[model samples]
Target: MTSNAVSIKQIMTTEVLTVHPGDTMEQVHLVFRSSDIHHLPVVDEEGRVVGIISKSDYYSISNAFPLFRPDLRAAANDRLFKSLLVEDVMTRQVATLTPEDSISIAAGYFKENLFHAIPIVDKGGMLVGILTTFDLLNYFFNQEVFLPT
Candidate 1:
């Protein structure tokens, strides 16, 4: 490996918000609506990563339900969101990496799969952090030291 080869640990966000399988979509919606984050990793009580929920996943499923239509009454959307569980909409097949994994590896996955975010887990399969495409860009540009526009 190169002397300066960056690893996922160097750029991953350690503090992350998560949801559980039984949590309602309404809770997920609230998190998405209230924050600027694009992804939420789903974890069990033991902190093991089980699935993932992306903003796109939420919106895509929203459209799948008739009541979530913007034209429909707000109250209906509220009720529907409350009724659906995170397990119902979250992607069961999740890809993850460890903090020690190289950024090159993560970049390859992001490029090939077009994933916006990838959760980072420990050896025990516990959620630890998240690596996002934006984080990669930030690290890349910082390394380049772009001048003011």
Candidate 2:
């Protein structure tokens, strides 16, 4: 089959690292550092995705307020940053994909959007997996066993 025929479920990662709206910024910071991922899906108590957090969002907050350093002007912002929650910074308007969607569809989303990752959810809007550009690249370059002639 051609790449266009390949479904996202075949390439998407079922084991996803997710966060909640109530998670603290510090907790998200540590998760970002530890997961080594660029994006995370924020879910609600019922497991429905409500938002998304990207590494750039964290950088934007830091650059806008400079929370890491103990400089003169940043003191007030630093305190505020520490007290801030993930929901405050995460993008509430998130783009998502379904498991059955084709990889071509996901590629189109990536081409149209500035983000590199897309959250894969079921009909109930519950997070099931994640798909990233890296996953696409792996399919193109490394999944030689399944690539069609």
Candidate 3:
């Protein structure tokens, strides 16, 4: 069964914020800090999806700075942010979907994987949107309809 028995385009987020390979961790950090999004699709100059950065990925990488140093932690984190690039840490082997893909297929992807988000791309591999588990929840909760058994 799928959501609304339709394409995930109905629930995917089109106005997605992104980061680039060359971007500093601090730059991406600001975006993560400011937004409620848990995943950021990393795109190239041509807007082609190259990789993805999850909030957990960011935190896990940065957490290497300290175990619990309240004082040195800030400076260490700041240093890491300045030195590391998005490409240096992002997951390069990202799974992507098209806007027209079936919601059931995407739900299956979510069910089978540990990741929570998938970047929506065009036939040419240009990113157009993103779909997350949370988006599916919103669809389930907000829609007046559901796929019948």
Candidate 4:
């Protein structure tokens, strides 16, 4: 079969780690480190994706306030870091692709948005899987077995 006939689900990683809106920054950091994934889909209680977070997002927060170090003790008057939350740093507007979506369509979205990964959802907008650039590349370049028609 041609590559176009192959659905994204065939190669996409179905195991996904998600963060809730109320999750703390420290928790998110731990998840990122353990999962070894830069992008995370932020979901609500209903399991619907509400936002996306990236390593860059955490970096941006760190960059904005150099004084807010984990080792540093906050003075009684200091409140800059304590008020920070995931909802404040995560990208509320997220781009998503459906599980049945063609790999070509996902490729185009990646090109247009310059995204490294995209959250895959089902028809009901529930999180299903995740598609990354590496997944597509591996599928396209890997040797496939072919039998006589």
Candidate 5:
């Protein structure tokens, strides 16, 4: 099927890893470091997508407060980093697509924007999945059967 024919549900990753608005920056840092994905959808208490956090954001803040090798200094730095909330740094205005959106729509987004990821939401505006340029590339290069027209 062409990209226009294939819905985002077919390619979007449903196993979304999300953070809450009140989550500590240090927790966001750990998630980014451990996960292979670069972008995180920030959700509210009700699990609705509220914002987005990129690896770049994490690095930008964490790097500015680098921990010293000394235990005392490292502890102090760690405390400072942990005190910041994800809401303080996450992008409040996020671009999102519904599960019904087609791959063609996602392609258009990637083409026109600098951001690499888009959160997928359900009809109720609840977080459902995430789509990234990597997903698009993987679909085009590895899954040739679904190549766009």
Candidate 6:
């Protein structure tokens, strides 16, 4: 298939790791570490993308109110901020793409929204897979055949 003909479903990472709204920040951090992914689609009981969380989001909340002066040593012991919930720190307004969408379209959305990763949803709006800039990069760079005119 031509590069343009390749769809997101072909390259999207199907193993989706999600978090519930009530999950604590500390719990989410463990998920992040275990999954080895920075973004997690926050889902409701029905598996809809209610929100999204990123490492940057957690760091932003954790560092927003520093207990002490902004010192490297002081910041190392920031475990006190882990009490925050995913709902408190996650971006509720999330941008999502469908699995059938073309890779080019997904790339454009990522570029326009400045998003590193976006959650993929099915027709019912259920979380399916995740597409990242890295995935797209790998698709283009790893392919030996370039699209023909």
lDDT per prediction? 0.89, 0.85, 0.89, 0.79, 0.88, 0.84
lDDT of 5 at 36: 90
lDDT value for model 1: 0.89
Over 48-131, each residue of candidate 2 has an lDDT whose tens digit, in order, gives 999999999877765674545558536655565678888998899899999999999999999999679999999999999999
**Candidate 5 lDDT for residue 6:** 88
Model 3 CA deviation exceeding 4 Å by range: 1-4, 144-149
Q: What lDDT does model 3 reach? A: 0.89
lDDT of 1 by residue, 1-149 (tens): 33148889989999999999999999999999899999999999999999999999888866665655566656666787999999998888999999999999998899999889999999999999999999988887776356455
Candidate 4 Cα misplacement greater than 4 A, ranges: 65-82, 144-149
Q: Per-residue lDDT of 39-64 in model 3, one digit per residue for the tens? A: 99999999999999999988997788
Higher-ranked by TM-score: 3 or 6: 3
Clashes of 3: 0
The deviation in Å at residue 91 for candidate 6 is 0.6
Cα-based TM-score, every candidate: 0.89, 0.85, 0.91, 0.82, 0.88, 0.84
Clashes of 4: 0
3 versus 6: better lDDT goes to: 3
Q: Report clashes for each candidate as comma-separated counts.
A: 0, 0, 0, 0, 0, 0
Candidate 5 per-residue lDDT, tens place, 1-149, comes to 67888899998999989999989988887887798989999999898999999999877876664556576656765886689998999999998999899999999998998789999999888999999999999888866566566
Q: Candidate 6, which segments miss by more than 4 Å at Cα?
A: 64-82, 145-149
Which candidate's TM-score is highest?
3
Error of 6 at 55 (Å): 1.2
Worst 10 residues of 2 by lDDT: 65-74
Which run of 10 residues does model 6 get worst, by summed lDDT? 72-81
